[model samples]
Target: MKNRSNQQKKSDRSTSQGTSNIALMALSAVPLLMVLGNSMLIPEFPKIKSALDINQFQVGLLITLFSTAAGLSIPILGFLSDKYGRKIIIVPSVLVYGLGGIISGLGATLLDDSYLIILIGRVVQGIGAAGTAPIVMAMVGDLYKSNDRSEAMGVIEAANGIGKVISPVLGSAVALISWRALFFSYAILAIPISLGVFFLTQEPTHQGQKEKLSSYLKKILQIFREKGPSLLISLFAGMAVLFILFGVLSHVSDILEKEYNLKGLTKGLIIAIPILFMSSFSYLTGRYLKQKGKFFKIAIITGLTIVGSALFFLPFLKKPYIYVGILTIMGLGSGFVLTSVNTLVTSSTTSEQRAG
Candidate 1:
């Protein structure tokens, strides 16, 4: 009888472990999908600009509007996720994201002057994006503890880096079918991912009374009070690296096309080199930082210094390969910076206060 009981307990533990691994994969998809929403459209910018008969600055608004809407909506969506549950916010938001994509694709294909319609659809997509990757960060915190939390956050960042690595190539390839096809792909992709998040991942059950808004606010404030400077620095570092990364990618795409006369897959392959370095480094960084809480500050500083040095030399280089080499160095720095920042922020507070 005792042997049977022990066997049963072992079986349960194995089952639980398997479920957790599946859940982690679904969660990782959240960031990757969110990245595809924007990054996948980047390589098509010139084609889009020409199609819509818009200037560079005007065409740029598509990305700008999406980001702006997402930024503005994130806090509201975060609060809702805190109240309702991460999956609830994520599932519907993903559907909305898909819907927005369909709308944009239709407008681009069917309308004569569809620029405004496309912009509107991007705004909708942005709102959906707001509830995705950011909530996944908090969701991971809710689901894991201690060293697992660090490792999971690292995987999340790595997924994000991987998305960056693939998006340019994916975008270029899809645009071959038709640039409008790119917008429609979002809907197709979101359905399975949302279903996975809804079904495969389980949200941790919160026991006891839900905190009132006042109490929640106070707890959040206290966390900031204790870790305000470090938190702020981490936030800034994360944002700065992404800004540098996307800005470099946009510029590089244009340079490849106009200067080198490279287009489509060749251009995309070149663009992906740096991002591949970033993703590879991000995974390695995450593994190294596991349970080593003391090294967060040092990692951030080292990563930023590497990025700064690379950026300094970038303008002086006239050769495409060398320029790409410098960006690869930058990507390496970004991988370290982002993984460290993600782990630090997620681990800084309890799940209850994470969204706040």
Candidate 2:
């Protein structure tokens, strides 16, 4: 009976994909790769700092530069992708992303001033990173009609969480062989994935009148004024949630190794549990919202409250297991917030403003 039930479940799970869905799945790799490029580096910080002959503060700039570049470039790139086409921006962005990785790997290999060169490469990666993730999100809006958009967004968010889950383990394993290999591996993986997305996916149709820069700027301002506090709240809340998420994850390795005497694969496995909660919950939330299609505002508020509650009590914890338990709770809120709010943003404007 158990065997029959297992077989039945397997049969039920099997579903087919069209060329577009296939392409969308491949496109999902951009965020996964984008995340892996950074998150994987968490465990490698000591190695990088030592090899580059840099201090902790200078070493920290590697993350800051990539994030700074991505943040600065996203709005501009979103506008361009909207103006031009998703494919044009995405293809080139992937190429630039690979080039940046290659350059970073080479700098670490051949140069004395590896720090400066790798920093430049990371900045370049950030520039490329800026273009890809948002374009992919915009592509989701472009590719799927409104009914299917939420599911697509959920899958992408789950992919992002999965990448975070995998990065530490993958990074740790690869570091066993060579820490520099992780840099090159992203370049190697990116080329083919980008190409697959390019060839398989059809470009989303752009219609109607094109606006001048002045007109577009005015329209964007108009959107801001109309959306007002709602948009502002979403933006700030997204930032704050992630600030807690990454900020906590950033310190995990040190705490686990120093406090608990854990390292390597064991450490990586331990670090991944909360993130796994995030991904699984994100997938479920996406499905839930896709069907129920209500409580979006409520869910977002609830998610924020849950995250706040988790952070408030964290200072009193002693056991590593309890600490991780709270982090998992934080992940639950993050997953909820990610699914609902992202769908809101993607659904906010269906046409020209969707990408912008």
Candidate 3:
């Protein structure tokens, strides 16, 4: 009788853990979807500018505003999630993100000042998104054993690649009908996505060890004092340089059209070549990291590729095939760097600190 009861208890524990992991996976998907919506907007920039009667710079500002808001809010929301619980932050954040999309859609349809309204909506969306990506990653840190955590992180990273893959094509198609419809379509997805997260994912229980704000601040300060400076420096330097490279790449479709006289889908295909290379390399790097445990080496290779590609672009900017080759090298480099960074960040932090 005792043996049977012990077996039953073990089985119950295993079942509970399985359910928790499934929830974590679902929660992870939300951020991937959010990123998809964000990336998809990139290709639709021209259409949006045309529809709203805005200039290229103004359209660029929209992208800037969204990223800036999200980046600034991440630590704040991360702190809140640590204090309260994951679900408390996540559920509300998802709804707010969806609301932003809806508001942006409505503004695009109803208002003459659509660009202004869209900007406001993106800010709101960023606020919510700030919580989604990091928190989901933090939750994966919370739920899994240390050895399994990398695989979980890899899965999330893969989902992100999948989002990037589908977003441009899907976003472009919707924008074709009406750019406003793109926002509305994303908003609709958000509603169902949020509901899924709420119902499926459990809020991890806080272990009754709440710290005072002063202590929390002190600890956070200490974390930075010890580790923050280097990580911040690396993150900022890497992200800034890469952002400029991506900005140049973003104009490739236009370059092809203006300089090479390619049009329509052909122009898009030329632009997509880099993303395709990026996605393929991302998948391969994630798999290799899982198997080889050589993240630092891979990252170095990626960095060298980026520098080489940039140098090559200086000389061969006019040749279409050469541009593609250089960009592909850049894409491969980016994939390795991103995968390694994410793995390192997740691996280096403890659960409590990761929640921050």
lDDT, each prediction: 0.86, 0.79, 0.71
Identify the runs in model 3 with alpha carbons over 4 angstroms from their true place: 1-25, 146-150, 227-229, 256-272, 279-308, 311-316, 319-323, 343-352
Writing each residue's lDDT as its tens digit, candidate 1 over 59-85 gives: 767888898899888867877787778
CA error at residue 197 for candidate 3, angstroms: 1.2
**Location of the lowest summed lDDT over 10 successive residues in candidate 1:** 206-215
Q: State in Å the error of residue 97, model 1.
A: 1.7
Output the lDDT of residue 135, model 2.
Answer: 86
Candidate 1's C-alpha runs over 4 A off are 1-3, 144-155, 207-237, 283-309, 312-316, 339-352
RMSD of each: 3.4, 6.8, 3.9
Candidate that would win on TM-score: 1
| Candidate 2 C-alpha lDDT tens digits along 225-246 | 8886777788777767776776
Measured on C-alpha atoms, candidate 1 has an lDDT of: 0.86
Model 2 lDDT, full chain set: 0.79
TM-score per candidate: 0.83, 0.80, 0.81
Ranking by TM-score: 1, 3, 2
What TM-score would candidate 1 get against the native? 0.83
